[model samples]
Target: MSAAPVIVIGSGLAGLMTALTLAPMPVVLVTAGRLGQAGSSPLAQGGVAAAIGVDDDTSLHLADTLAAGDGLCDAASAREIVGRGRDAIMALESHGVRFDRKPDGSYALGLEAAHSRHRIVHVDGDATGAGIVKALVAKVRETASITILEDCRALRLIKRDDRVVGVCLEGKGPVAARAVVLATGGAGGLYEATTTPLGNLGQGAALAGRVGARLADMEFVQFHPTALAVSAPRLPLISEAVRGEGAILINDRGERFMADQPGQELAPRDVVARAIAAEIDAGRKVYLDARAALGEGFVRRFPGIFALCQEHGIDPARMPIPVRPATHYHMGGIAADCDGRTNVPGLWAVGEAACTGLHGANRLASNSLLEAAVMGLNAGRAIASEMTAATVRLEPVSLPQMSDPAPVRAIVSRGLGILRHETGLRAAICALLPKAGHDDAAAVALAMAVAAFARCESRGSHARTDYPHKNASGTRKLFTMDEAFAFARELAASQPLSRTA
Candidate 1:
C-alpha cells in the first residue's frame, strides 16, 4: 500500500512552501481560514533577508543575526541557515515569487536595523508578504498532489505509541497520516496589541505541548517598535524597512529620543522597542518621522505603508507617522532541529512555530521569511526521504476544545509586555494555571509566564525591570507542558493569597 499523505497544518509561508516542495508526493494542507488569507505571513511587511548583495556575504549576515540574538543564538544552526540565503532566494523565485530588482537585474536590497549591509529582498516595495503569498498561493493551487482544506483548524496531534501519526482536526476527528508538519506561525495574538493575525494564539505550541513536545525560549517575544499606534486588536505594522530608509523616532514634544542610543533609529529591535515603550509609559506619543529622509519619495518607496497612512488620515510625506511597540514575533516555540524534526517521531514544525535556535532571543529584521522558507523546504525533503508506507489501525481520539485567547489576553498583556517583572509574571501564572488544563491558550500563556519567570536576567527582547542586567551566562530553556505545569503549581502553592491576588 502507498504511504498515507502527509498532513501539513496551517497555510502560511512555511506550510505552503512545505507542501509545494513535497511536489508529486501526496499531501494534505489544512488551514484555519482560507489559504493565503490566514496567519502572520501575509501581514509581514519586511522582506526576506539574504546575503545576496555584491558587498555582502553569509558571514556578515550571520554576524548581524547573532548580534541581534543577544547571547543565545545557536552558532552552528545560524551559520547553516544564513549560508543558504542564495539558495532560498533562488528557490522562492522558482516557486513564482518575483523579488524586487534594480535596473541592472540585481536583487534590490534594503537595509533594516542591525544589518551591517543592505540585504533585504522584497517584492512590490512594502507589500512584500502580500506579493510573495499571492505567488505561492497560486503555485500551491496548481500543484496536483496537494489537497487543500480551507477553514479547517487542527486542534491536537494524534499520537500512537511513540510517534505522532496524524492530527485531530476541530470537527473532522482523527485523519491518519504518515507524518504531521505544523507550520502554525507564532503566539503574538496572545497580546492585546500585536502585529500577527488574531487567530495565532500559539496553537502550534499548544498542539505540540499536549503531545509531550519540548518548547524552548518561550519568553523571548519580539515586539516591533513601529506598529501604527492605532486602536485595533491587531495593529498594522509600519515595517522596519521604513526605519532602514532613514526614518527617525520622535516624541510628541519633537525630541529625537533614539538619537543618543547606540545605532539610533537603526538599533536592534529590542532597543528600539524598549525606547518606544518607555516613551509611552511616560505619557508621550512617539512617531516615525520620514519627512526629511524619504519625504515625497515615501509614496513611491512604501506604497502600502502610504496607503495605510492615508486610511488613517495621516500623510507620511508631510507629518510623522504615529508609532508604538506591539507584539510582532515569537522567538520561542516548539523545540525542533534544523530540519524541523521534533523529539517526537513523525512530527515536525517550521516557521515561527519551531525554535530551531537560528533566532536565539531576538530575530534580525526580515530573517523570519528566510527561516520559514528554508526550514519548510528542509522539512519537506527530510520527510520525503524518511517516510515509509505502513499499515496501522486507527484508534479513536477525542478532539480538543477550540482555543480562545480572549480569556488569557489581559493577563498575558500585563505580565509579558515589553517589560516584565516577577510580580506580574507570578500573577499571570496564578491566573493562567487554573485554566491551562482545559484551555489551550491558557496552557501556552502559562508556559510563557513560567519561562519568563525562570529567566532571572534581562536579555534580548525579554526585559525584566527587577532583573535589569544580562546574566553572565545563559542557555536556551526547554520544557514540556507537564514541566511548566509542575513549576506553576509549585510557585502558586508557595505564594501568599495577598501577593497572588
Candidate 2:
C-alpha cells in the first residue's frame, strides 16, 4: 500500500478542498466511486451561500444561518464560517469554477430559505454542484501532490489506543498515514428514504466512534423536507432554490398554503418539510408549483431541475413537481475545531464528516458547499502544521469482514427510521446491538443507537416524542464507541419498543 502523510476518505468538495489547501503535501484520496460520482455535491442544484452580495455581509449571513440552525449552532463556528464566506467564494472562482453572472458582470445571485438577502451564487443555472465539482476535479487532477484512488471504500479506522492511525480501504487493503481525515460525508443511507448519495451510509461517524473520538449531536439528522419521491432508496433531492425563485408549496387541491405556516417553505428546512409531510400523510399530494410562479424562467434559471423533471416525465415549465421529505445532511459527526482537528491526535475531519457546529439543528441551504471549501482548506494546513516525515510511517491494514446487510437495513429503516418515538428507539437499540458482532455495520448501528438513547429530549432535527421536552441547555453530548454501545445496550434491556416509534 502506498502511504502518505495525509489520507482523505471521499472526494467531495470537502476532501478536494482539503487536499488543494495542502498545496505541495503528498496525500492519498480514497473514494468509493469515481472521485465525484458517489458524492451528493455534483447532484446539488442550488448555489453556495456566501455573504458576497451588495446588500449582504457576514453578520447578516451569520444571523440567517443561526436562525435556521434552531439554537444548536455554535456562535464561534458560525461566525468563522460566515466571516470567511467571501474568501470561500473567491477560492472557488479562482479554481476556475464559472459561476452564473449577470449581464453587467455581477453575480446573478438568487435567494434561499432563511436568508434575508439574495446571497446564493450559482453556475450554469441550477447546476451549481456540477460546475463546482468540475472545477474541483480538474484541480485535483492538476495537483501533482495529491493521489486520487477511485472505486475504493474506507471500511473502518485503524485505531491504536485513543487515536486513529489510518483507515482500511475495503478492496485496497490497509493504507496507513500519520493523520486521517474523515471526509466521507453523511449517514443518510442509514435510513429508508434519503437524499444523500447511496454510499453515504454513515461510516465515517461510526469509524470515529470506534477509536473513542468525541461525536457531537449524532441525533440531529437533517431531513431535507423536499426529496422527490423517486423510485429509489436515496431519493433525488428537489432543490430548495426552486422555491426561492417564486415556486409555491401546494397540496393536492391546488392550494398555496405555506405562507400561513410557521417559517413557510422559505422557513427552516425541518419546519417546511415536516409541514409538507403532514399534508402528504393526510392523503394529499405535496408538490412544488413552480410552473405558475417561475413560468418560463424555470427552464432558464433551473436547468438541472428542469432536466431532472423531464427525465422523470414531468414538465416543470407547466406542471407542478411532486416532493417529500428525505434524509439530507447529518449534523453530528467527529467533533472538530475550526481547523478540522478532531479529539484524536493524528485524526482530522472536514466536510460532512466533521461536526464543526456551524450548522446546528438544521443546515442552511447551500452552506454545505461553502463549509466544505472553507474547512477543507483549513484542515489541510492544520494537518501539515502537525506532521512531518518523521511522525509515522504507513502500515498495511486489512478490512474487517461484514455481516449480512439485509437485517442491518431492516433494523435501521424500520426502527431507527424517520419519526422515531420512545418505544422504537429503545427497541431498535435492543435489536441492533447484540447482533453487532465485530463489523462496520454493527459499529455504525451501535453508534446510532447510543445517540438515540442519550438524547432523551427532542431538539433540532432529532424528534423523540418519549423524551419530548427540549432541553434549554441542549448541550452537545459527545460519546465514545464504548460509551455509546454500553448506553445503547442498557437502554435496549430496559425500554420496550413502541408501535408508533
Candidate 3:
C-alpha cells in the first residue's frame, strides 16, 4: 500500500502555506468548513508586518514585537522570526499574493499600534486578509499533490507510544498519517463578544493537550479595543489601520479619553483596551472618531471598513464609529518550537494555535500573519526533510464528541475577560471541570481558567484586579491536560464555588 499522506488540520494561512510548501510530498488538508472560509485569517483586517521598507529593518520590528510581548517573549525566537519578515513576505508573493504598492512601485507600508515603523504590508486596503487568502486558495486548488477535505472536523489525534500516527475525523473514522499539523486558530470565540469566527474555540490546544502536548501562556487573551459595538454573533472588527491613519478614541460626551495617555490611540492594544473598558465600565460609551483624520478619504483608504460601517448605518466620512473592546486574539497556545514541532513527536502546530514565544503576553498588530507564514514555511521544510515513505499501523480509537463552546462561553467570558481575578477564575474552573471530560470546548476553557488562576500578576493582555501590577520578573506557564485538571480539582476542593451571574 502507498504511504499515508501528511495530514494538515485547519485551512487558515498557516495550514495552507504548510501544505503548499510540502509540494509533491502528498498532503491531506482537513478543515471544518469550506476552505479559507472558516477561520479568523480571512476575517483579519490588519495586514502583515514586515521590515521590507528601505527606512525599516528587522531590528526595529523585533523591538516592537518584544515591547508588545511585555518581557515574556523568547528573545532568540523573537529575533529570528522578525529577521525573517522580508523572507515570509517574499514567499507569500511567490504564492500569487500581491500586496498593495505605491505609485513608485515600492510596497506601500502602513503603521499600527505599538509599531515603531511603517512596516505593515497590506492588500486591497483593509481587505488584506481576504486578498491574501483568495490568492492562496487559488494556488492551493491548483496544487496536484494536495488533497483537500472540506466540511470535515478533526475529533482527536491518534497517538501511539507518544507519537501522533494519524487523526480521527468526525464521521470519517481514522486516517493514518506519518505526521499531523494543527493550525486550528485561536479561542476568542469562547467570549460573549469576539471578533474571531465563532467556531474557533481553541480546538488545536484541546487536541494537543489531550495527547499530552504542553500548552503555554494560556491566560493571555488579547482583546481588540475597536470592534464595532453591535449585537451580533461575531462582532465586526474596526481595523487598527483606521487608527493608524490618525483616528482618535472619544467618549459619548465628546471627551478624548485617551488623550492623556502617552501614545494616545496608538498605544499597545492592552493599554487601549483597558482604557476603553474603563470607560464602558463607568457607564460611558466609546467611539473612534475618524472624521477629522480620514473624512472622505476613509472610503479610498479603507473601502472594506467603510462598507461595513455603512452596513451598520454609520458613515465613517461623517460620523464616529461606536466601538468597544471584544475578545480578538489568543497569545497562548500549544507550546511549539520554531519549526512548529510540539513536544509530542510527529505532531506540529502553527499560526495562533501554537505558542512559539514570538507573542509572549500580547501580540503586536499585523505580526500574526508574518508569524503564520514564517512558521508555516519553516515547519514545511522541517517536515519535508523528515518525511518517510514507511507506513505504520494505527490502533483503532473511538471518535470524540463534537465540541460545543456554548456551554462554557458564559464561564470563560466572565472569568477570563478584559480583567480577571481569583474569585472569578475559581468559579469558572468549578463550573467547567465537570463538562471538560467530554466537551472539548469546556476542556479548553478549563485550561485557560486554570492558567489565569495561577497567574498572580497582571502583565500584557492579562489584567488582574487583585494584582494590578506586573512582576519585576515574569515567566511563562506551561501545563499539560493532566496538570490543568489536577490544579482545577485542587482549587475547587479548597474554595467554595463563587456565584457568577
Candidate 4:
C-alpha cells in the first residue's frame, strides 16, 4: 500500500539507466511525452565517447576532456567519469545496444572533434541515439518493478524541513516518495534556436533553485557549430562526426575559412562555433561542405542527417549544407557531487540537470552520452544504498504558473546566445527579472543571465565581447536564486537607463 520508494522525473538515458540499475526496487518513472520522444537522448547523432580502442586509454581521454572544458573542469570528476567509460559501454552492450562493429569482430571506433584518438562507439552509423534509446526502452518495458507514468509532467519539487519529500505533477497531483531524482535535461529549449527537445525548459533546475539548491556553471552553454539553418521549430543537427570524417566549412565567398585555424574543421566546438558565428555576423553565409569529402557515402553513413537535409530540400552530396551556431548543450546545472547527491537531502540530480564538474565550460563531442550513462549508474547505486523504509507522505502543494516562453526565448537568444557583451547582458537581466515573477522558465533564464554577468571574462562557451580575455583566476561559480536576484537588482539599480525598457 506504500508509494514507490523512488521517483525519477525524466525519460532520457540517465533516467532509464537509473531505473534499470535499481532493479527489483519499485520506482516511478515520469515523462512529459512518450518515453523517448521528448529528450535530447534520441536526437544524439555523434554517439558516445569511450576509450575502448586498442590505441587509446583513459589517460588520453581524460586529457581531451580537460582541454575541451577550458580550465573549469573538475579534474578528479573528469577522471572518474572518463575512467568508467569502457565499463559503461560494456554495460550498455549487455543491455542489448548493438554498436557498429568492424569485419574483424571489433568495435568500429570513430573520430570526433577535440579528441586525439578514434574512440567514439556508435550504432547504425548516425542513428546512434535512436538505437541506444530503443534498446533501453525495450528493456525498461520488460521490468515489472518499474512503473511508467506516460505524459505525466513534474511541475515542482515538494520540500519539507529542508528535505525534498515529493514532486507535484501538472495534472495527476502530488506523488510523494522517500527520494526524488531529477534527471530532467538542459535549458536550451529556453532559446529560440536550439537543438534540444522542446520540452527541455529547465524545469528541474528551476524546481531545485526554488528550493534553495546550489547551482554551478550555469553560464557555460555550448553552442554547436553545425545546426542546420532552416525555418523550423526544431533545429536539425549536422553531427560533429561529419566534420571528423573530412567535411570543410566554407563562407559565402566559396572559401574554406577554417583552413586558417589550427584544427581546421575539427577544432574544439567553441572555436568552430565562434568562427561560424563570426562569418554569419560578417554578412557572409556559412556552410558545411562535405561534397568533396563524404560524397555519396553521406546518405549511407548518416541516414538521419541525410533525411533531415532532404526533408528541408537540400542534398549534402551535391550542395553545401547551411550551418550556424545554435544552443546545443549546457555544461552547468544543480551543483551535485559525482554520486548525484545535491545539497538538498533526499534529492538527487543526474544527466544534464546535475553539474558533476565532468564538463567544465564546454563539453567535448560525444561525451554527453558517456557522462549520462556513467553518472546515472553511479547515482543509482548510491541511492540504492541509502534507501529506507520511511513512509511516503502525499500533500497538497501549490506550484508557480510560468508565463509564455516566447519573451524569455527572445531575450536569451539576443543576449546569451553565442556572442555576448556587458551592456546586452545587463539589459537582458533587467528585462528578465520582472518577467521571472513566479515564472519558472524566466527564473531559469535569470539564473543563467546572473551567472553569465558575474563571470567578467570569457572562457570557453561563455564568450564576452567586452571582457574578451580569460580571467587569470580559474575559479568555478556556484549560485542560488537569492544571489542571482541580488546581482540582477544591483545591476538594474546601477544602470540609469534601460535598453530593454
Candidate 5:
C-alpha cells in the first residue's frame, strides 16, 4: 500500500521472487512477519522439482507432474513449467542458491512420493527451503528498485468493477497500482494443526473470489502426511523428504504399515498420511522411525526438526517421531496461466496463492517449492511489461469491521476440517450463516464452499464421506458464492426435521 508502483502481499519465496525478477521496476514487498518468516518456504525441507538430471527429460517430468495431478491438470500448464524449470533453477543459482552436489560435482537429487525419478535439487541436505530463501532475501535486500515492508497485512483487493486497481491493508494505507500480484500463500491456518505460518489463512484466494477471479480446486487442499502432533495447537511439521530419505512409518507395536504404496517407507503424501491416520484410528500411536534411517546425519541434515523433536524428548537420532496428517497446501486457488496472469486484468497470483494447475488433485512431494520459484519468476516478469506511465491512485478504503469469529472458527474447525460429511457440512453451514459477518474470514469461508459443494466426488485431499466416489467427475467444477449457498440450501431443505428437537 504505501505509495508504491507495484505491491506484493507476503514475503515468502513467491513474493520475494516476484519482487526480484521484475528488477528495476518499482516494487513494494509487504509481509505479515519478517521476509523469511511467514509462509511455508522457510519450513520446506524438500527441494525444488525440476528436470535438471541428464536422463530426466522435460517430457518425463511433465508425465510425472500430470500423473500426480490425477486427471485435473491443465496439460499446457504442466508442459510449460517442465520446459522452463531449468531456467528458473538457473535463476535461483544466479541469485546465490547453493544446491547440494554429488561427488563428481553434479547437483544432488532425491526421490519423493509418486515421482518417476529423483530430481529434487536441494540447497542444504535437508533444509533446502531455508537456504534458498536466505539467498533470495539477501538478493532482495540489495535491490534498489524493491521496497520491503515488514509487519503489514493485506486485507482485500480494491476492485473497480472487474479490474483490481489496488489492495487494502490492515494497518497501512492503500497503495494503488495498475496491476496487483497476490503472492500471499495458502489456507493452512484454517485447520487445527498446520505446518504453515499463522498468516496463511486463504486470504489471497478469498480476495480473488471477492473480485470474481475464477477459482478451481478449492476442495483439494494437500494435507502433509507427517506433521508432528503434540500438546501444541498448530502442530510442527515433519518434512516429507525425511520419508524420502527412508524414514519408516511405524505403529505403537513398531510395525511398518505403509506397504500399500510402492516403496513402502516412502509413498505419495496422501497415501502415507491416510495410512498414518488409519493407524491412529485403529487405537495405535504412529511414529516416523528415523533412527535407523537417518542415524548420525539426522541432526546435521535437519537441525530445526532435530531440535524440535529433542524439545519433546523424542530424539530423531535414537527414536521415531510422532506424526499426523495436518493441513499443508491448497492445490486449488485463483486459476492463472503459466505467466501468473488470472482471468481478471490488472491482477496476477503466484506461488501457493495461485492455482496454476501444476498441482492437480494432489501435489507430488517437492513440486510445491518448485512451482513457487518457477511461477513466481514468470509472474514478476509478466508484471514488469505494463503500466509505467499509468496514473497511480492510493485512496484509503476503510478496513472491513470484524466480529468474534471464534464460533465460526470452531464450527469450521470441527465440522469442515479434515474428513467431512454432508450431514456435518449442512450443520456447519446452518451454524455459520447467522455469523457470516462482513469480514475477510467469512469471504474465505465462502471461497472454501465454492469448490466444496461443486465436487460431490471425494477426489484427492478433499474427502466427502456422504459422497465417497473417488473417480473423476468428468466436467471441471466451479461455483460462485450464491451457487455455493444454494447448494447448502438444497441440502438443508431435503433433510427432515428432528422429531425430539
Candidate 6:
C-alpha cells in the first residue's frame, strides 16, 4: 500500500509553513476563507522574533522566553525552539519573506517588550505578517504538489480506531489522508473584544478535543494592551513595536500611567494588559501617545498602523490613539510535542493550534511567528517521515453542530476574559458546556474555563480576582474532552448557578 496525501487544516503561517515544508509530497491545504484574506497571521504587525543580531544568542532568547512564560513554559521545548530561531528566519526568507534590512546590509532587527535584544525581523516596517504571508502564498502557488482548498472550513477529524485518518470540511465533504496537520490559529475570536481574525473561533482546538487529543495550558489567554478602541467588529492591533520605539501609554488625564511599573511600557504583555485593564476599571480612558516620541516618523515607521489610524480618522502624527486590552493569543491548544505529534496517531498539530509549551503562560511579542515557523517546519518533516506503507481507514465521522458564535463569544468575554473569579468561572463553565454541546469552539471554550477554574491563583495571563496572587506551585493543567466535561459538570453541580450566566 502507498502512503496517502496529508490534509492540513487552516492557512495561517503555521499551515502554510507546514504545507510548504512538506514539499515534493502531495498536500491539501484547507482554509475557511480565501488565501491571504483571513487568519491571525497576516494581521501580525510585530515581526518574527529571532536572535540574529551579532550581540545576541539563543541562550538570551531562551531566558527572555522563559521569563515571559511565567514558569509554565516547557523549558526543553523553549530552548529547542528558541535555539532554531535564526534557522527559521532563514527558511522563511528562502520562501519569499523579505525581512527589512538596514542600509548597511544587515537585518533591521526591531525591539519588542521583554526581549533582551533588538531581534525582531520584520518586513515593510510594520506589515511583517502581510509581507511574509504574501511571499509564502506565492511560493505555495508555484508549488505543484500543494493543492489549496479556499473557502473551505474543516468540520472534524475522521478517526479510525485511534489515529486520525482525514478531515471533514464544511463545503467539501470528507477527504481521506494518511496524516493530518492542524494549524488553525488560536481561539481569540471566542471573546467579544479581540485582535484575532473573526473566523478564528478555536475551531482547531475544538476539532482535536472532540477526538480525545490532549489539551494543555487552556487558561492562559494573552491580552494585547493596545488594540485600537473602535466600534468596529475586528479590533486593530497597535503593534508592540510602537511601544518598543519609545511610545508611552497615557490616560484621559494626560498622565504617563506606566511610570509605576518596573519596566513601565517595556514590561511583559501580561503586565501591560493588566495595567491597562486596571486603568479602564478605574474609570479612566487609556491612550498610546506616539505623537512626541515617534513624531513625523510614525507614518514612515509604522505605515500599516498609521494607515489604520487614518482609516478611522485619528491621525497618529498629532493625537494619541485610544487603546484598550483585547483578547489576542491563547497559549493553550491541542497538546503536541516538538514534532507536532498529538496524543493520537496520524494527527499532528502545528502553529497556534498546538500547545507545544513554547508560549507557556504568556507568549512574548513576535514569538508567535517564530514558533509557528519553527514548529510548522518540524511538523512538516515529521509528517513526511511518518508517511509509511501502513494502510489507514477513513470512516464517515459525524460533524459537530456548533451554536451561534455571538453567545459563545459573550460567554468567553464575561467568564474567561482579562479578569476571572471562582463564582463567575464556574457559572461560565456551566453555561458554556451545555451550549457548546459537541461544538469544537464551545468545547475549547469550556476547556479553557475549566482550566481557569482549576487554577486558583493568578499566574501569567490566567489572572484570578479572588485568588489575587501567584501560587507557590507552578502547574500546567492538561485535560481530555471527557475529563473537562465531567469536571465542569461536577464543579457546576457543587456550586449555585448564576441567573445572568
lDDT of 5 by residue, 122-234 (tens): 87677888998999999999999988888877776787667788888777667676578888888877666677775577778777777778877777878788888787766
Q: Least accurate stretch of 10 residues (summed lDDT) in model 1? A: 492-501
The candidate, 3 or 5, that scores higher on lDDT is: 3
The digit string of per-residue lDDT tens for model 1 on 302-376 reads 999999999989999999999999998999999998899999999999999999999898999999999999998
Q: What is the C-alpha lDDT of each candidate?
A: 0.92, 0.80, 0.92, 0.89, 0.77, 0.89
Q: Which stretches of candidate 6 lie over 4 Å from their true place?
A: 387-393, 498-501
RMSD (Å) of each candidate, 1 decimal? 1.1, 2.4, 1.2, 1.3, 2.6, 1.3
The deviation in Å at residue 205 for candidate 2 is 1.2
Per residue, candidate 6 scores C-alpha lDDT tens digits across 372-470 of 999989999888776363556555668777567888888889888889998789878988877767666777889899999899998999889999898
lDDT of 4 by residue, 274-315 (tens): 999989988999999999998999998888899999999999
Model 2 Cα lDDT, one tens digit per residue, 1-501: 443568888888888888888878888888888876778788888888998888888999999988877788999999998888888888888888999899999999988888899999998988888889889899889999888889878877876656677677776666667688888888876777788776676778777776778888777788887788668756877788888878888898988778797657788887786678778878999889887788888888877778878888988888889998887888888899989998888788898888999998778888998898889878887887874633445466555565665566677776564467756666667777777646666567667766866677776677776776778877776777777777876665666555655
State, as a TM-score between 0 and 1, how close model 4 is to the true structure: 0.98
Report the C-alpha lDDT of model 3 over 327-374, residue by residue, as the tens digit: 999999999998899999999999999999999999999989998999
Relative to the unseen true structure, what is the C-alpha lDDT of residue 299 in candidate 6, on a scale of 0 to 100? Answer: 93
Clashing pairs in 1: none
Quote each prediction's TM-score: 0.98, 0.94, 0.98, 0.98, 0.93, 0.98
Please identify which of the two predictions, 2 or 5, would achieve the higher lDDT against the true structure. 2
> What order do candidates take by lDDT, descending?
3, 1, 4, 6, 2, 5
The alpha-carbon deviation from the true structure for residue 189 of candidate 1, after best TM-score superposition, in angstroms, is: 0.7
How close to the true structure is residue 418 of candidate 1, measured as C-alpha lDDT?
A: 93
The local lDDT score (0 to 100) that residue 377 gets in candidate 1 is 89
